[model samples]
Target: MESSTQLVILAGLVIGLIYGAVGLLSGFCLMSSMRGWLAQGDGRLVRTYALAMAVAIAASQLLAGSGMADLGKSIYLQQSFSVPVLFLGGLLFGYGMVLSNGCGSRALVLLGRGNLRSFVVVIVLAIAAQMTLKGLIAPARIALVQASQITVNANSLPSLLAAFGAAEATSRALATSAIVVALILFAFAHPSFRRSPGQVAAGVIVGLLVTGGWFVTGFLGADEFNPVPVTSLTFVAPIADSLQYAMLSTGLTPNFGVATVAGVFAGSLITALATRRFQLEGYSSPRHMLRSAGGAALMGVGGVMAFGCSIGQGLTGLSTLALGSFVAVAGILLGTAAGLRGSLRVQPLAVA
Candidate 1:
């Protein structure tokens, strides 16, 4: 069982590496998608992201319905829900992503393109996230979780459908189909989005990567003796966890999240180097540097509180159709809007 679990984890690493390479190569970024749609009136990026979310939901549901995996064991669909944490975390993460000029996946893409600022953002995000996850701030986080917990039996939409007397397979299939159709309709409705094959393909592939992470950890990492935490892609805490693992690897075993984070950075680096895009750059000003650092720290704290970042809870967790994930995603959208539309004077880079 242990060996089998190890194999599963190893397979997840490989899948993660593929995902990282594709994401970097294609410049996939949920943050940019959302921000662009809201701020610049260009909905293509957000539409692509939505399409990916739909694919992730449909594929994950199919996997679960076929008995290939069970998403209930994953952290996103935990029986206990916390609204304050989810909302607060989402707000922080959204603002942070905006201030840093990217999310985790975006950082990886930019790093590949020789952006030094993104490198600092990634490093700060990883460190601060680790600080919130299991380092100095963990005690406070635990206490908060204990205080705000709300218990429920069926945390996922599929399980809710199952409660309504639908057969397990039927419930999952119907739910998944509804979401996929909605997403497909939305994506195709926008002519601009429909024309971008790179964005479309990136969305679909990234969505699959989320589902692939679930399979790698939930099914593959399952073991009677040494079970792993159920999770998919999320940037905030995992970045921190990766940093922690680098320092404490002798005392801890590699988990899917940590491995995936490492794979994303390394895979992007390889792609960048191979394509001659790798370079080191930094913030244009002290104010910009401050924004990046503060954003990363807030993302670390908020991501842990909310249970995921945009990709983690928004795409990966939502794939399970979990109620908490939905709430978190909603909060993310709202928070992102606040940052983009509010009085803070958030501006896009020229990127020339």
Candidate 2:
């Protein structure tokens, strides 16, 4: 209703559009990247992902450093968090991503390209996330958090550094520089990745979009009377919120998340149509459908518990250097590894 809110919503839509387009064009999914690197022995996509993380951290920290945004206000920087719960959630979301063949954002992009399989994934994931957030699963989730959550003086890497006697700005700069440099070096280490300019650009743009989301909420929407939630790009809860808003439009007002979700679908749809990439697709069989549905449900519940999905914890949350984000990301990587390799790997379906 307020002008600042409207601006934030508009910004969210624009950011989502860019993200959807970039994701579709560049194949920017962590699951796919991991599979490529670990299974197929390709590393370009993974490099792009690493670059995105680096850029996100650099840009986000710059914003925070300049006092343009308050990174501390975000949920990832909580003083008390349950390590076990977050790690478990990440593992579930990661394994589910492998089963579903993508994350929530990827499903949205694919759905826009007329993948009926992704449509199923999106719907089921949303339902599962909603249930976990507020339905029958909420009590259990809450209880677990209450039981395992621990309090700490330093909630993030930078904060921890500061607690160890480093100046606030010095801590932020040191942490950001170290992580960003390492990621960038890793991304550029491969000649193959260095050759793909489009992928490189996609990574940069996606990272900027994450920072843009923070700016929209933390700066543009920082109204004293109607303060918006200081947050950025994360898919799990947003996708669920989008679905709820769709069904209950009369009572609910659209937020940045809802607008971004809708924009992602619309952007991907338009791009697919223009590029002649839109095509109808469906599950191969009942067994395939069951697998997808199960994966979606797991992703829903897991994403909620972890406080983010691949893009959420992996990129946006990590940009803040939160200790819990590191734990969750580690869990996700391990879970993805389990699904992609070793005896526990989910094998390719045999075509009947």
Candidate 3:
């Protein structure tokens, strides 16, 4: 039998490679999607995002229906609802993404594209993630979660459907199909989006990546002896976890996120070098740096509280159709709107 670490490491590398290639190729950016719709009146990027969400939900539901995976095992989708936390977390994450000029996945992609400013965002996010995960803020987080915890299970649309008398497979399939079809219709309805093959392909591929993450962690990582943490993509904690692993690799074994994070930067660096996109760029001013720093920190804290960044909870976790994900996604939209809307004067600060 293969060692657990070996299996996990292999999965991580594979997932990482896929994500890196996809990130580099498609220029997938949730922050861009929200910003485009709000700032520029362009909905192509948002449509791409919606397409991915639909595909992810459909594919993940199929997996769940097949009894190949149980999405309820993931952390973000709790049985009992926490509306306040989810909304607040989403808002924080959305604002932070705007401040950083992109979400976690977008940041990684930008880093590959010779944007040094993204490097600062990633570093700050990672540090803040660590602080929230097990550092100074961990206790408070734990306390808050415990204080307002509610008990619910399988908090997904499929579950709700099943509760309403639909069979397991039927309910999952219906829920998945409805969401997927709606999203695809939305994407195709736009002429501009139809012409952007690069963006469309990226959306589909990234959707696959999200589901693949579930398969790697939830399925392959399932060990009767030493099970791995059941999770998918999310930038905030992974960065911090990556930092923590770099410092304590001997003590802490690698997980999918850690491996993926490493792969993103490494793969991006390699791709950038090959494509002549590599450069050392940084903030032109202290204010710029401050915005990046603040945005990253908010993403860390908000991602932790909300249970994911755009790709993490919005796509990967939400694919499960979990109730918490819906709440979180709503919050993210609200927060992004606040930052992207000029009427609110949410200007992007200069970098340090």
Q: Which of the two, 1 or 3, has more TM-score?
A: 3
lDDT of 2: 0.93
lDDT of 1 by residue, 217-250 (tens): 7777677577777677777776777777888999
Weakest 10 consecutive residues, lDDT, candidate 1?
A: 343-352
Best by lDDT: 2
Cα deviation at 350, candidate 2, in Å, is 6.4
TM-score of 2: 0.99
Point out the higher-scoring one by lDDT: 1 or 2.
2
Question: What local distance difference test score does each model get?
Answer: 0.79, 0.93, 0.81
TM-score, one value per model: 0.92, 0.99, 0.94
Q: Per-residue CA lDDT of candidate 2, range 1-352, in tens?
A: 9999999999999988888888888889999999999999999999999999999999999999999999889999999999999999999999999899999999999899999999999999999999999999999999999999999999999999999999999999999999999999999999999999999998999889899998999999999999999888999999999999989999999899888888888889888998999989887789888988998999999999999999999999998999999999998899889999999898776432
- The positional error of residue 305 in candidate 3, measured at the CA in angstroms, is 0.3
Which 10 consecutive positions of candidate 2 have the poorest summed lDDT?
Answer: 343-352
